[model samples]
Structure formats: C-alpha cells, structure tokens
Target chain A: MATQDKSSIFADIDEGEVDQEDENVDRWRRNLRLWRETLAKQWRMLTDDLMVRLAMITIAFFMIVAVFAPFIAPRGPLTRQYEGDAGIIIADWVEPSFLSSESEYLLGTTAEGFDIFSQLVYGSRAALLVGLVAAVFTAGIGTLVGLTAGYYGGKIDDTLMRIVDFLYGMPLLPTVIILVALMGPSLWNILFAIIVLQWRSTARVIRSQALSLRERPFVKAAQVAGASDWHIISRHLAPNVLPLSFLYGAFAIAWAILAEAGVSFIGLGDPNTVSWGTMLQSSRAYSALDFGAWWWFIPPGICIGLVVISGFLIGRGYEEITNPELR
Target chain B: MSDTGAPDVSDENPLLRVEGLQKHFQINEGLISSLLRATMGKEADYVHAVDGVSFELERGETLGLAGESGCGKTTTGMSLVKLHEPTDGRIEFRGMDLTESDDEELDEFRQNAQMIFQDPFESLNPRMTVYDTLAEPLRIHDIENETARIRRALEFAELQPPDHYFDQYPHELSGGQRQRVAIARALVLDPDFIVADEPVSMLDVSLRAGVLSLMERMTEEFNLSVVYISHDLSLLRHMCDRLAIMYMGEIVEKGATEDIIENPQHPYTRSLINAVPVPDPDVGRERVELAGEVGDAIDVPSGCRFHGRCSEYIGDICETDSPSLEQKAEFDDDREVSCHLYDSCGKQS
Candidate 1:
C-alpha cells in the first residue's frame, strides 16, 4: 500500500516546504514522517468514500490514456484516410472497422479522414492539461490575493474584493468566448480563458477563510513575535488556508474541463488540437450524428461527460478533507 | 502611578507605565455610516472596550488583572502589547511613550514585549512544528543558534528530552504540552515583559498548575514583568503579586493580592470575593447575589459604573455623581478604590 511506504525514496511531500534547518537532516526526516502521517489520514478518507473511489478510477483511466497517447495510438490525430487506390483522401468518410470486417478503418473516419479512435485517445491529454494547469494557476493566484486581502483588510480588501465582484458579474461562457476570440483560439488560449474567470470562486472562498484565519490567535502570535506582514501571510496564514485552496482547486478542475469542451464545441478550439471538443465539432461536418455515426461522435462525448463528472466527484470527496470531522 | 501600590524597587525607571489607556472600537464601520454622520448629522457609536485604565509595574512584578468576561480585562492586556492600538491614552515603556513611538522604537518595543494567548489549541500554528514555533520568534529578532535556543526554551518549559518534541505538530501533542510550546515561544525572544491572557484556562484543570508554575519559574529566572488576565479569582490570587479588579472598562479597585482578596474595599470587589464558590458542603455561607448583569459598556452608567449592581447603593449621590479612585484612611495603605462610600468621594463633589 502507498501508506506503508512512509519512507518512499521519492516522497516529495511538498513543493515549497521550508526545511527550517536545511543542515539538520534529522529534522527533515522527522518532518517527512509527520507529512506521511497526515497524507495517510487524507488517503484513508479518500479511499473510504465510494464516490471518491469511482472518481479516482475514472480519472486514473483517463490519465493512463493521456500519458501513453503516443504509444497507445495506432495513427496520428490529424492523419488523412488513405484509400487503397486513391490514397490520402481528405473528404472521404470511411466506414467503422466493426461495421465491415475487411475495412481498414477502426471506429470509422471523419470526412477530413482523421481517425476517431486516435483522436479520442490523444484528446485525454488536452483535457487533463487544461484541467490541471488552469486549476493550479487558479488556486495559486486566488490564495495569494485572498491572503493579502484578508490580512491587510480595509482598503486593500475592498479594492481586491470589488475586482473579484466585477469579474463574477461577468457572464462566464460569454466572457470566456470573448476572451478566447480576442486571444486567438488555441488550447492554451482556451485554458487561459477559463483561468481568467474561474479563479473568482476560489478567491472568494479562500478570502472568507483567510478573513477568519487572520483573526486566529496564532496569526496574532506571529505578529507579536516580530514577524513581518509578508512573512506571517506566507508562513502562517497561507498554510492554514491551503487545505481550502486544494478543495477549490479540485472543483476548478471540473469547471475548467467542462468549460474547455464548451469553448471548443463552439468552434473556438485549437484547429491542430485533438481534444474531445474539437472531435465533436468536426463530427458535425459530415452530420455524423444525423447519419447515426455514433462511433465518430458518441465516444468523445462520453469521455467528456465521464471526465467532468469524475472531477466533481473527487472535488466532493476533498470537501470532507478541508473540514474533516474530529477523528 | 502604582494603582496596586506595588513597591517600586526600581523607582528610577519602572519597566512599564501606562496612563489613561483606552481602546474603543467604532461599531458602525462603513461608508453608509460615514455618509449618514456627515450629511445627516447622525452620531457615531463605539463599544468602549477599554476606557481610561492606568497602572505601573516594577521589573519582575506579576500583576493580575481580574474581571468578569467582557469587562475589558483581556482588552487591557492586549493594549499593553500594542496589539490593539490605544484609542486615547499613553503607554510608556521604560520612559518611552508608545503612542508616539516611531517604527524603530516600536520595533524595539515589539522585541522587548511578548504575549502568550489564552487558548493553546488556537495560539500555535498547526502547520508549524514545535521547533519551528520556537525558532520563529528568534528568527524574527535576528537571533542566532536556532537549534540550541529552541532546545533551551523546551527545557525551560519542562519538556524533557526536548529533542523528541522538536518536530511534533500542535495536533499531535496533549493540551498541556501545546501550552508549554506556547510558553516556550513567548519566552524564546527573552523579552522584558509578557501578557499572558488566561494562558491555562483552556487546559485540563490538572494541567493548569504545571503551566502556571512554569510561567512563574520563567518570571523569576528572567526577571520578567507579566500581566496575567483571567476571570478565575483563585488562579489570579495564586499567581499575581498585585491584583486589579475591573468593572466596565475601569479599574474599580486594586491592591496587593492579599488585600484585594481579604480586605476588598469596593462594594463590587466585596461581592466578587463573596461569589467565589466554597468547596465544603457543610459550611453554610451568605452569598450576595448581584441583582443585575454588568452594565452596558457602551452607554456606561453616568455615576460609578457599579452603582446599578452595588449591594450598598447609597442614595442620590451614587446615582448622579461619578467617583474617582481614592485611598481611604481606613483601608490598607497599598489599596485604592473607586466607590461612593469613601469620604474622599464626598470631598470631590
């Protein structure tokens, strides 16, 4: 079990964990032990939950496909359908291999001759990339802003919170549509569009938390200890709010994945990308759904729904973690 | 002024001298209120959390501030450390006026003063280890020898084999152990004074004595001035050399601990001592049940704040005229009381 490997050689417990005394390896080792115990407790909570297990299994499956796309895919995402006599046809809709035994095509092909199976396999990469990157940046920015607003309060709080309110007042899809339109359509642009608007929820939730946390006696003790404002925010206040940050980060992954699909379905996706959104958009060219080409369209649609729902289920599991019941 | 009549052994320079310390929090805090007050001439309101309290301490003296909760005892302690900026008053530290002290002097004051908060569970950061909590103060003050200093503080706090606790988080330790870490952190900077706001009240009763004695030992070894704030009269009587009884953001009485506990002069003080529960069930005692709750601190009583609940409410004078803190010829030379019963109050009117 992962819990048993407390001393795992590659146990990187934190990204910016303070060593306190970098020279004291014993201190580091003890901290590692402490970190493992805490992580194990959280792991138990996650594993014990049925919804969380389903979410994990689904996400794990997508992750495997995403990570091994190059090795697993039999053809490139944008490869043309090459017929026996007329090779490399761009406008031919090939039949699905299951429909005909001798047909070379697997899960058929688009009018653009792009293989549906290859594109679906590689599409997981786009979904996870946008989901993970957007979630990270969203949580990171929100946490910093929340800490500053909550710690310094008064005018800074008013100003920052007003900005957040303004962003929230903006309609999400429409604003993201405008943002993607203005920034030019690409996978990263779509990711950026999601991030620009999505950080608001994390910021609001974390800001309210930071508001209460700053009033905690520990934060005041740090102040009485002669620590600077930045030091207190980073070392004391930020760490306390991190669990809440992670919870929001999980919800944001679900939001971002769904949003990317929405933007791409509106024909604003990266033309070169093989995301489920782009696959769905391209399926419309041959009216594959009207012609009942469920193989060409339904697989990508199901992948999108499964991944997004799994993200939400995992996010629900993490909510229990942030405000865990007394053990 | 030494309101508690604590002997001034170091008379030339008392460690701390506070005069008319007041901390009032404005209740209506918003743009709408400001607009109303500006355009419509509406009056602003305040909580009057700590109003016009004053005292002085010699180096190494332990002053106990005893009052019912919300009587501003904790606010008084917090003001001592500049945790809540005084609304209107002067706090002098070693002859330096804190209200007007520049950043450099304030920083010096911050280094010299520390506070151990009430709840150990809430006082120590959960994310930080014991070693990190202790090292934070030292690091902030630019002190060296981080490891040795942390070990010594743990030892001082009576945590045996201090190294064992070096990496333990707050949640992992018992309540008593967490309070010890808090004490260790407060004293790590070697500050001249510390404000302990009910430090052990949240601990198990069995653990309170051990933590209190640890603080006492820290005081003697370091010659530290401490302001112990608690509503527990017995605990204060045990820990404080001098005691000040607060009533509605004002010090109604203060004297040597024995005098306040034994020869309480103010009617309010007398009632407070009488309220302490006796352990012996066989012993019958006459209890003075206070007629009403503590008066509203915002719209404070016009006369003596305690007159509304005073057991010996003396006629119209008690209702109309405010009394100043004065020494009666009858009470101990060290004692002072702010009550209408004192003949000195008659002279003032």
Candidate 2:
C-alpha cells in the first residue's frame, strides 16, 4: 500500500495528488458541523434555567425593540404631541391612553408634552448600542493585555497588572463621571468611560486564567515544539483562556449599561441623545415622583434594570459552561 | 567528569552530544524579593537543577537516565531538547551548538529534536482534538500534507485505523492510547532525537508494555536516538542500550545497561539497583540502607553530592572533595563512578 519514496512515507501511493479544492470543501463542512453542534450545546446551557431563559428573552425583546424602533415607536423621539398653542390633544401632563381616555400618549407624556412611549421605545437603541459596542472593545483590549501579560509573564505581567491595579484604585462611578464631564456629556464619551474602567475586571480575571494556562504542560509542549511566543499565546493560550474573556465580556455589557445610566441619572448624559438615561434626566427635572407620574420615570428604569439583570444572567450562564464546578 | 557511555570517542559525529550542561533556576524570580535580597546584600540563590551533566547518544540508541526523584534527570532531559536553555555548557546536535543557535537554527533544532513528556493526561491540550494536537508541530514548522502525515504517524504509533481517533479529545482515549498519541505527536516531524521523560510512568502497569514496545519499534523504524529519563532501574535495563545514574544533578555512574545494572559501582547506583523489587520471593536479594534523605538541590552537599546518603563513606575526603566521574573500577573498563571510595585517599592519610 506504500511506495519506497522516503520523502512520501506518509503519502498514499495509490493516490496521485490531494485535490486542494476537495480538502478545503471537506474541512469547511466539518467546521460548519462542529460550529452548529457547539452553538446548539451553548444555547441549551444558556436556556436551561428559567431565570436565565427569561433573561435571554428580555435581551431578545430589547434587541427587537431597538432594531424596529422606527416602526414600533408611535412618533419620532423628539416630537412634542402638543406644539405651542396648537395643543389640540391637551398633551401637557397627559396620562397613558390606557390609563385615561382623555390622554392619547400610550405610555403617557412627560411634563414637557413629549410622548414618553416613543422615547422609551427609541431609548433601547442607545442602551444596546453603548453596551454591546463598549463591551466588545473592552473584551478585545482586556484579552490582548491579559494574554500578553500572562503568557510572557515576569516584567510584562508586572507592568500590565500594576496598571490594572492602578485602575482598580479609581472608583468606577466617580472616574466615569469625571471622564464624561470632561468629554462633555455625550453618549460616546459615556461609552469611553465605561470601557476604560470595565476592561480592568476582564483583564484581571483573564490574566489569572492565562497565568495558570501558560503553566499547563500543553504550553510547555508547544514551547518544546518550537512555537514562538506569539504563536503560543495566540493559538494555545488564547483559546484556553477565551471563556474567561467572554465571561467578563458579558459582565462588561452590564457594567457599561449601569455606568451610563448612573451618569445620566446624575444629569451628565448627552442633552441631545434619546437614551433611557436622558429620559430619566428629563423626567426627574419635572419631579415626576412628586407629581405621581410613575409612567414618566418607571419604564426607562425598568428597561435599565431588565437589561443589566439579563446581562448578568447571561454572563453567569457562560461561567457555568466554562467552569463546570460553578454549575 | 568522564562522558556518559557513548561508543568510540574518535568518531566524528554522533546524533547528539551534551557537555557540562547545566540549568539553574533562581529561587526568587520576583522583582521585589530579588530587590530586597539585593538591598540586604545577600547573594541571590538558585536551585542547581542540572549541574555539569554530560552524555552522548548515537543514532537509534536509547540512553536511560536513572535517578531518584529530584535528582535533575528530568531537567537534563529538558535541557537536551533546548526546552530549558542551558545556563552554561554546550549541547551539540549533529555538530550544531543548540544554545547559541539563531532562530532559524533553533527552529531547525526544534524540528529535529522533540520530547514526549511524563504525563499524557497533562501534555495534550484538553481543548484540542487529536488531529489538532498532532498537527500543531507540523503547522508551526510549515509542514504540509497534514491529514496524511497525522494518519501515518498515528498508525505507526499503532493507533490502528488512525481516523478512529482523529476527532477524539485526550479524555476520550485510555491512558495507553493517550501516551501513543503523545508519541505520535513527537514523531510526526520525523525528528532525529527525542527525550522521553518517563513516558509510561503515568500509565497503568498493563498499558506500559504496549507503549514501551511501540516506542522501541519506532526508534528502529525512524532511526531516532532517544534519551529516556526515569527512576525505574528495571525498566531502564529492559529498554535502554546504556544507562547513566544521576545524583544531585551530576552523573554518578554510567555504562552499558548490563554493566550498570549487573555490577553497579557507585553507592548511589547500588542503592538504586537494590531497591528494585526482584519479583521472586525464593531468591532474597541483599538490602543496603543508606544514610539521610536526599539533600536539597539548592544547597547541594559540598563534596560528593550523594555522600550523605552513601553507605560506603570510606574516608574523610568523601565529605570534603567532589570526585570526578571516571572508570573507577578496573574490571569493567566501560563503567564510571564518582566517589572517593575508589581513590587512594592519600590526602586523608
């Protein structure tokens, strides 16, 4: 079944050449199958718990609402139901249409004659946007720093870890508030603030995971195989420590959303944006709590609570899978 | 020290040659602690893991490095593959000095020399499939025909119909099967030399013979010279062509497998050979109990490293001078021992 060609001891004598096209197609199909199975398993684990399932559902609902805000929201977020003296609908202090037939606003109107329904629907976009985008950047930066620090260790670990320690020394909310104030209360500035602090937790956790991972015999085996430092970090250590990065990534989303909401509650949110934080700021200015207008403040607050809770639940699901002992 | 048992010194080149190889690990690697030591004016300490070790291997020959745990046998094996860069001395593989080798040469060295570690459970990455594990070195060295090569290597290692295991993870295989996969990974590149540090020590007794026979067959088939590091003297006698017994990071005694096992020269070697269970109650072997426990590698005994535990403590010189490994016994010209017991003890008198 074999030829005497010393060069091709592994080669099949009967098979003249390996068709690169066939090999690529075969590998592609295999990888696709593997991906499908892995995704199915992860989905099962994530949805196994009733709490986690509800959390997933909440995230899904927010995602849908955010994507379809234009159609789902009854009016433009900035549209005032009553403009100047036209005021045909008596939009000022309008109660929810469901609560009182006299009001036309679905989730009621703010004291400023704005439809709180439209603002609430449109606000989901900002929360999801800042949370997901900031989390991605945070996870990427944290994973890079952690993998490099832990794999190369010694001096590099000391430098990066000390930087993380210094960052940890800063209080999260105050630092974010000062940053947002300096950058002038924009959504992007808020996201930047959240990302700056949020990456540290991921970096610290991933660095510990990477520290233990690099010491595993597999890493030394890779070294013995003559793998470069970069190759070992990327191919071997990164994949093993990836679950920790992702776990922190899920938590970063929650942290970003909460940080943004906290800043917005304290009136540092962007004046021009339609985020839940801005909604809360606008409602709070009119003393909605004093006026018994729970609709004005409660929906955005509930939305923030649901998103953060679900983010944590989703992160816990990932942790259970990555660390079975946590299950 | 005289070199560990290699045939014919005049020969131009053997597969691998190691001389005065040493590897020391600093006790305090942390910046703050080391700085604290510097401030205190205390010299930094190190664990002399592999100290002044020398050995050579011919093509297709197996040299078993035998010693108790913590005797630096494993460290010497690691140093041989350049896994632990020598703190000093030379490791020349086919006349190429590995320690000073540039990236290209180091890369070449990596391809030509490989290692099979002690634990199969720990060595294979838990996440990687068998295919990925075997394909790692090939991908690193840019070797192509991965599937075919992996299949052949697996089959050669006797994981018959190797495709059966291509998709499985390490946990899926039995201990013996995992060791075979480890061996397959090492041999995938067709390396000229390999260091197997107790490859089967972690396997069950039933599975050990199969892996060992497979390795013995692979050595012949691939013409690969191997340095096996293990404390099991009987296993060494069964598997090795020649044997070197290390004590406190130095080669204490070395010779052909039969010479070292049949007539061990040094007190340490004798104690090691005596400890092996004979498996026969009818023929009771003499037991020789030595002195204290193995000394700390950090503060190795000044004179002969094994002098504390050596029962044949002949003279005062045993505690004062380090004896060079030489052909100390006349009857067996090949065997070497490092002990003042064989010396005239002129200074003590």
Give the residue spans of candidate 2 off by over 4 A: A1-29, A84-92, B1-11, B29-32, B344-349
DockQ of 2: 0.42
TM-score of 1: 0.89
- Cα lDDT tens digits for candidate 1, A239-285: 78888888888888888888898889889999988899888887886
Residues B1-349 of candidate 2: C-alpha lDDT, one tens digit per residue:
1133222331457778888999999886677988898899998888999899887888779999998888899889988887787999898876668877787767777887889999999999887889889988988887656777788899898998988897788988988998999999998987778999998899999999999999898887776789998998888998899999998889998889998898887888888888888878997778987667789988878888877777878777888888987765454356667777784223310
Expressed as tens digits, the lDDT of each residue in B86-153 for candidate 1 is: 99988998777889988877877787799999999999999888988988877777755567667777
Number of clashing residue pairs in every model? 0, 0
TM-score of chain B of 2: 0.92
**Where is the poorest 10-residue window by lDDT in model 2 chain B?**
B1-10
The per-model lDDT (C-alpha) reads: 0.83, 0.84
